[model samples]
Target chain A: MKTRVIVTLKSGVLDPQGKAVHHALTGLGFDGVNDVRIGKIVELDLADGTSEAQIDEMCRKLLANTVIENYRIEQA
Target chain B: MKSAVIVFPGSNCDRDLAVAFRDVTGKDAAMVWHGESTLPDGIDVIGIPGGFSYGDYLRSGAMAARSPVMRAVAEAAARGVAVIGVCNGFQVLTEAGMLPGALMRNATLNFVCRDVDLTVANSQTMFTSQYADGQSIRIPVAHHDGNFSADEATLDRLEGEGRVAFRYAGNVNGAARNIAGIVNDAGNVLGLMPHPERMTSDAHGGTDGRRIFEGLFSALA
Candidate 1:
């Protein structure tokens, strides 16, 4: 089984890199862009019988900084 | 006071921090490797020096924060041991959840490296008691990710509790409310981007940073 963890900065937290990327996009003449926020994606390959709770625990422990970021787990 | 300086693989300021600790505490500071799971017994102060720890990979200080040594540092911090994190150390602290706020890239998207003016925001902290309130001093900061940000309510509460220990006299980084340094809720942990250790001696161009360690000892006494 493979799992993907998507980590993103929580709303209202300042995202300077995201802002920089947004500025770059605007400079490139991309329109209809409302806002841009940067986040991380971690893909994991787990053995059979890996529980969702275990994946959530991993995300909670290290994949996401709970103080400033949130994480969601997807299995495929 | 006995001290220890955590040395990550890429830590460049570990020796400088150890020298500062020794000069102020009158005892040699142990250089503890980041791979170590336990620190030497009865350490009083722990210095997490600045550097491109883990090569600034996966986010600055992110990988280092999850290292084995940080666990010991966090436990020591909880036990009332004084912990000071500088530059990359500050990033590690925030990543480790030992301090509030995140250090983002500089708002100007530049790596700032110079002696900048700072105002003593709260002299009550063990880290700042040596300086008088509102006094100005200069310290060198070299970092790309030093911009500090927190939510409004947390910022308000930090201000309300007098935990905002230092503020930039000028806009060196785009830190909220000009915050340069802050203390943890228990007041035992401090994380700041400026290199106070580098400015601790007059021979180093200024002794303004000496008082911080002096204040720490005095507060402990």
Candidate 2:
């Protein structure tokens, strides 16, 4: 089974990189860009019978820092 | 005082930290590899020096935090051993859940490297005993991800309890409340983004950092 994890900075957390990108887009004449938030996608190939609890543990322990970011796991 | 410095694969400041330990305590600090599962016996203090550990892969200090040696460091900390984490080491401590908050990229999105003025916020702890409360000192901080962030409640608790050890006299890194360093609840673990080991000697253009080591030695003694 393959899993996709999307990690994003929590709301109210400052995303400087995202802001810089947003600035560049505006400078390039893009219009109506409401907001930009940068995040990462991590794809994992797991063996059969991997439990959801185990995947959640992985996110909590290493994949995402709960203090500053949130992560969503998706099965594909 | 006996001490040990944890050396990760990419740690660049291990020697500087060991030198600081030797100079202040009159004893050579053991350089413990990150792969080791246990630290040497009788270590009163543990130093986690700065560097791009694991090349800052995944996230700053993420891989190194889960390394084998960190387990030992955590255990020692639980036993009330003094632990100091500097720069990347501070990131590792936060990742290891030894300290509160996460150090994100600098607000300005630039790698800041300079000697900045810091105020000793709380001198009552073992780590800051040599400095008077509100004393201004200069220390060098070199890092890209040194902006400290925690939820408002945790920040309030830290301030309320006087656990904040040092605060930037100027807004150097956009850390919450301009915190330069902080101590854990037990007051034995300190995590700071600045490199005190680099400022320990006058030859380094300042000896302001030496007082931290001296304070630790006297406290341990």
Candidate 3:
């Protein structure tokens, strides 16, 4: 089985890199961009019988820092 | 005081921290590898120095927080051992849940490396006892991810309890409330982005950082 985890900064948190990219876009003459927030996607290849609870544990333990970020896990 | 400095794979400031510990405590600080499952017996202080641990992979100090030695550090902290996490060490403490808040990229999107003025917020803790309350001092900080953030309620609690140990005199890294360093509720653990070890001697252009080590040694003694 394979799992994908999307980690994103929580709302109200500052994303400096995302802001920098947004600025560059504006400088390049792009318009109508309200905001931008950057995040990361982590793909994991797990063995059979991996439980959702285990994946959630992984997210809580290492994949995401609950203090400033949130993570979603998807299995396929 | 018996002290130990945790050395991760990419830790470059472990020696500097050890020297600071030795100079203040008059004892040879042990160098414990991150792979160790346990620290040396009867340690009074544990120093987590600055460096690009694990090359800051995944996240700054994220991988190191999960290393074998951090488990031991957490246990020691629970036993009332003094733990000081500086720079990357601060990131590890937050990641290990030993401290609250997360350090994000600087708002300037640039790596900041210079001496900055800091005010001693609370001098009652074991870590800041050497400095007078509201005293201004200069410390050097070198990091790209030193911006500290925490929820409003948590920040309020930290402030209410006087857990904030140091606050920047000027906004250096966009940290919330200008927090330069903080202590845990138990007052045994401290996490800060500035490198006190680098400022330990006058030869380094300042000796303001030496007070922290001196304070810890006297408290532990």
Candidate 4:
């Protein structure tokens, strides 16, 4: 099985990199962009019978920093 | 006093931290690698130096925080042992959950590298004992993700408890309330983005950073 984890900076945490990209996009003549934020996607291929709990623990333990970011696990 | 400096693979300032330990204490600081599960005996101070640990992979200090040696560092920190994390080390400590808050990318989105004025917030802690209350000192900070962020309640609790150690005199990074360094609730663990070890000697442009090392030993010894 393959799993995808989406890690994003929690709301209210300042995302400087995201803001910079937003600025660049506006400069490039793109409008109507209200805000911008950045996150990461981590893909993992696990063996059979890997539980969602285990993946959640992985996200909590290492994949994402809970202080500033949140992670969602997606399995396919 | 005995000391140990943790050395991760990408830790470039490990030697500088070790040298600072030796310069201050007149004894060699053991360079404990990340793979080691246990530290040397009778370690009074543990220094986690700056640099891109684990190449800042997954997140700054994330992988290094979960390494074998950090487990020992955390155990020692829990036992009242003094632990100081500088620059990248600060990130590691926060990621390890030994300290509150996290260092984010600088608000300017640029790496800040220079000497800046810092005001000692808490002169009573062992980490800041060498300085007077609200004294201003200059130290060098070189980092990209030095901006510190935390929730409102945690920030209030940190201030109410007088855990904020050093605050920047100016807005070098977009740190909350200009906080430059902070001590854990127990007051033994300190995480700051500035490199005190780098400014420990006069030849390093000033000896303002020397007092931090001196302060730690005077309290412990």
Candidate 5:
């Protein structure tokens, strides 16, 4: 089984890299952009029947820092 | 004082930290590898130095935080032994959940490297006893993610309880309230982004960082 994890900075957290990209977009004449936030996607190839609780534990323990980011696990 | 410096694969400042420890305690600091599950006997202080540990992969200090040696460090800290984490070490401690807040990337998105002024927010900590309260000292900070931030409640509690050890004199990073260094609730663990070890020797320019180690040694003595 394969799992996909998407990690994103929590709301109200400053995203400087995202902000710089937003600026570049504005400089290129792009408009109507309210905000931009950057995140990462981690794909894991796990053994079949990996329990949901175990995956959640992996996210909490290492995949995402709950202090600054949130993570979503997707099964594929 | 019997000191030990933890060394990860990419830790460049481990030797510098060891030298600082030797300078203050007049004894060589044991360089404990990250893979080691146990530390040397009778360690009075532990130093976690700066560098791109685990190549700063996944996230800053993320990979190194879960290493074997950190478990021993945590146990020693629980025993009231002094633990100091500097630069990348600070990030590791926070990632390991030993520190209160998280260090984010600099607001400017640049690697900040320079000698900046740090005001001693609380001089009563085991790490800052040699400095006077509110005294401003110059030290070098070289890191990309040194912006320290925590929730409002945690920040208030830290300030109220006097756990904040150092604060930037100006807006060096986009740190919340200019917080530069902090200690755990027990005041036995300290995590700071600045390189106090780098500033300890006179040949490096100023000896402002020496007082931290000196204070720790004297306090332990």
Candidate 6:
């Protein structure tokens, strides 16, 4: 089985890279761009019978920093 | 005071940190390799120097944080040893779960390298005792992932408890509340983006960084 972990910075946390991208978009004459936030997508290939709790532990322990980012796991 | 400077494969600042430890503590610091799971006995201070540890693979400091030696470092920290991590070292500390928050890429997506002003937010920390409260000092920072972020409640608690040790005096990295360094809940660990070891001598055009190690030695002595 394969799993995907999506990690994103928490709201209210300043995303400078996102802000710079937003600025560049506006500079290029693209309007209506309210905001931009950056994140990470991590995919894992696990053996059969990998439990959801184990994947959740992976995200909490290493894939994402719980202090500043939130992560969700999805089966593919 | 006996001390140790953790050395990873890509840690270029280990010697400099070792020098700082010797200069301040009057004792040569042990250059502990990353593969060793044990630090020298009775070590009082541990310096995690900056560099592109493991070439910033996966994430900055991610690989280095999980290295075998970090287990020993974590053990020492839990025993109330003073630990100061600088720049990439800060990232490692966070990844190792020694400090809170993750250091992401700079908001500008550029490597920042220069002397920037920083405010001493909490002078009571073992590392910041040489600085006065609210004092502004210049220190050099060289990193692409110095932008600090944390959840709002955690940030509030860090602020309320006076755990924040330093704040950028200007727009350096777009850090939250302009935080430059912070102390852990037990106050024995500090993780900062600025490089105090790089500025500890007059040959480096500044001595502002000297007080930090000096203060640490004095307090720990």
Per-residue lDDT for B1-221 in model 3, tens only?
Answer: 69999999999899999999998988899999999999999999999999999999989999999999999999999999999999999999999999999999998989999999999999999989999999999999999999989999999999999999999999998999999899998999999999999898879998999999998899878
The segments of candidate 2 whose C-alpha lies over 4 angstroms from its true place after superposition are none
Tell me the lDDT of candidate 1. 0.91
DockQ score of the complex predicted as candidate 6 = 0.57
Mind listing the fnat for each candidate?
A: 0.39, 0.78, 0.94, 0.78, 0.78, 0.67
Q: In model 1, which runs have C-alpha deviations exceeding 4 angstroms?
A: none
Give the per-residue lDDT of model 1 (tens digit) for B1-221.
68999999899999999998889878899999999999999899999999999998877898899999999999999999999999999999999989998888888888999999999999989999889999999999999999998888889999999999999998987989999999999999999999999898879999998889899977886
lDDT of 4 by residue, B1-221 (tens): 89999999999999999999999999999999999999999999999999999999988899999999999999999999999999999999999999999999999999999999999999999989999989999999999999999999999999999999999999998999999999999999999999888888878988888899999998999
Query: Which 10-residue window in model 2 chain A sums to the lowest lDDT?
Result: A31-40
Question: Which scores greater on lDDT, model 2 or model 5?
Answer: 2
Candidate 5 residue pairs in backbone clash: none
lDDT of 3 at B195: 92
Which model, 5 or 6, shows the larger DockQ?
A: 5
lDDT of 5 by residue, B43-153 (tens): 999999999999999989999999999999999999998999999999999999999889999999999999999999999999899999999999999999999978899
TM-score: model 2 vs. ground truth: 0.99
> Under CAPRI classification, how is model 4 graded?
high
RMSD of each: 1.6, 0.6, 0.8, 0.7, 0.7, 2.0
The C-alpha stretches of model 3 lying farther than 4 A from their native spots are none
lDDT of each: 0.91, 0.96, 0.94, 0.95, 0.94, 0.91
lDDT of 1 at A52: 94
- The digit string of per-residue lDDT tens for model 6 on B165-210 reads 9999988877888999999999999999999998899998999999
Q: What is the DockQ of each candidate?
A: 0.52, 0.90, 0.93, 0.89, 0.87, 0.57
Interface RMSD of each: 1.8, 0.4, 0.6, 0.5, 0.6, 1.9
Candidate 5 local Cα displacement, residue B172, angstroms: 0.7
